[model samples]
Target: MKKVNFRNKDMAWDISALILYPPGFNEASQYPTIVSVHPFGSCKEQTSSATYGKALAEAGFVVIAYDASFQGESGGEPRYIEDPSQRVEDISRVIDYAVTLPYVDADRIAGIGICGGGGYIFSAALTEKRLKAVVGITPVNLGRLFREGFSQYNPVAALEAMAAQRTIEARGGEMQVNELLPATPQVATENGLTERDVFEATDYYKTPRGQQPGGATRMLFSHAQKTLSWDAFAYAETLMTQPVMAVVGQKIGAFGGYRDGHEIYGRSIASKDRQLVELEEWSHYDLYDKAQPVSAAMEQIVPFFNKHLS
Candidate 1:
């Protein structure tokens, strides 16, 4: 593993990333590469990116896991804001940096993203043709989540509240933020977040298990406005012509269904090769770090990229 930094020209931020090289990697030879995007409000060191980076590197692919511009070690103002547009552009910027590396095979570059990062990767892949293949692990469509609520149960009130918050922020009120996870496991359970997936996510992201210094659970209120307008699957049918795969857990507790992943795959009508892999008995957060599910996900991921990028 090696740390690197690059300037995001479009966003004017310095992006920090870690590149993992396959064993016996030689700079003299070009190798297939994969860009692993981190989840929303997470950093390079978080579970998903790091896990996939190491696992994929061991499988003979150069994997680059990066911090989003405003979130982790990257440079950006009003920190911790989750802007979907900027997140999508970050993948392209990383690809820009990747193509310059001596050991990177430009033609074989692909992308993999977990959770919210998966949504951004799909959005990026819509127009970023350089990404020959894309993989999404238990992907969440942030736009849908923001506009329709996590459970898709009661979004009308949530949308109204978000709009009101946007108005307040636009009028010079202090920036409001919301916690992405419960403050404590006790609180999570008190709020009926006892489902295995939700409980595990709280444990992993909020507690010592997977917590990093910059990996906060709070995000700007304005994120709702941006996310509400952004659709991850916009123009996917025609624009997403690249081979794509969305690996979702069969029992995704947080979202309650695999509708988002299925929508992404189904909308990619122009993709000659597309797949939706559902892991039995796994939940949304299970794919984040649970050894068995992570390994199982990679089993599908490695071969998909290998076949497509070959």
Candidate 2:
């Protein structure tokens, strides 16, 4: 495990990155690489995607995980804004950086996106021909979530209000964006979501288990509205030509959201390589850490990448 920094696209934006490489890495040898994408508004540390990165690294691949632009240690002003297009571009930029490394096998690079990141990875994979195999873990399609609501999860009006606020921000940058998670005991029910949805989200942002001083949060109103318009699944039919693997937790309600979407992608596309794996007794957040099924998922991830990327 080594801490590293790489230059990103926007001026003054530098991405803080971590590289987990197998023992005996040397200029003489090139290894396969996996770039782990973190969830929306999350840094590399909070999501525990690093756990997957590290495990894959130890298993003989170079695992690179970094804070998304404008979040965590990554540089960007007016932080916590969510631009789906920019986030997807961040994945591409990270790949741009990864390919320059001498120890990395440029053709063998793969991606593992968790939570909202899962959707972003898919979005990028749709257009990024360089990415070989892609994995989506408990993906949250913000467009669908904001438009249709989840499992009778109603925040339609509240989300609309948020969108209106975003429009206001875009016209004139006056209002500071609201931090979605409240300080102390972090409330997730602000959007009229059920207690379970709120509590589950709070478990990650509030607890010492997943908390970071400046981790994931609500996007600025302008960015929020833009994300509402962006739909990654829309490109599923075109993107499914590449291998896509989706891992979900069967125990959680929101888990079904992406499962059905991925299935639709598989059905619509002509590719035979895409697959879906549901981990028994695991919930959405369980994949965020070193829980039982998460470790199992990690084990499966290496082989999947190996089979596809090699």
Candidate 3:
């Protein structure tokens, strides 16, 4: 296990990451590498990302997991400021750094993105041609989700409010906005949230289940406006040219991107190698190493990379 901190020229942030290869990794053994992008608010040490990276490392591939700009150990001003454009660039930069390592096989590089990272990697796949394969584990397509949320209110009003909020922040006012993720979950009701979305999210954040050092309980409010319209699905054609694997858990929540991406991707003749693996009785957070789903997903994930990487 080797930790490397590199500066991302595109986003102008000092990106922190770890590159884990098998114990005896050396110049003699050239191995495939997987660049993993974490969920929106998570860092490299978060359980799912760390476990997934280590799993790949143990299986003979070097795994690179890094914090996106403005999150985790990565550097950025006004912490938790979300930028879809910069995030995509950061993914590409990670790949750029990975390919330079002596132990890495540049041609066999792949990417795995979890949760919000699902969509981020999709965006990266479009322009980063060096990536031979991509995996989205319970991905959240920010574009569609944001569109759905924005539909409830007038888009004009929402944009106006965002602009006003930015104005305040620009004037050095304290950044005040709701960053939602409950530390403790309450019982679910007839409200829009299902048991899994509300309770499961709480369980991951509240308990020691998947906590990372210095992890935030609340996020930047302005980030909500930033993530709403960041749609990566429109670039399916570019992404589909490379092999893609999507994993979703049936029990947790229905991730629309996998279904939606499949719908768009299946219609193409060129997108032949794309595959979707639906894990039964699994929740979104369950993919984050919550026993039942993690083991099964890992079974599929390891083999998928092994088969494609070589």
Per-model TM-score versus the true fold: 0.92, 0.86, 0.89
- Which sections of candidate 1 miss by over 4 Å? 150-173
Tens-digit per-residue lDDT, 19-138, candidate 2: 888878886788888888888767787663456776777788888888887787888877777778878888888899998989889989888888888888878887887788888888
**Cα lDDT, all candidates:** 0.85, 0.73, 0.72
List, residue by residue over 64-178, the lDDT tens digit for candidate 1.
9999877888988888888899899889899999999999999999999988989989999999999999988888888787766552556666667778887887899988877
Candidate 3's displacement at residue 257, Å, is 5.9
Clashing pairs in 3: 252-283
RMSD of 1: 2.1
lDDT tens digits, residue span 1-310, model 3: 7778997455566888887877678877688988888876677887534668888788888888887777778888778766788788888888878777777888899898887787788778777878888888888776665566433446557666777887898888878745456545543333445556556766776667777763554556655576666677665764567777788877645445445445434532355477778887776777877666777877888888887888
Model 1 error, position 277 (Å): 1.1
State how far residue 136 of model 3 sits from its true place (Å).
0.7
How many pairs of residues collide in each model? 0, 2, 1
TM-score of 2: 0.86
* Shift of residue 87 alpha carbon in model 1, Å: 0.7
The lowest-lDDT stretch of 10 consecutive residues in candidate 2 is 146-155
Please report the TM-score between candidate 3 and the true structure: 0.89
Candidate 1, residue 55: how far the Cα is off, in Å: 0.5
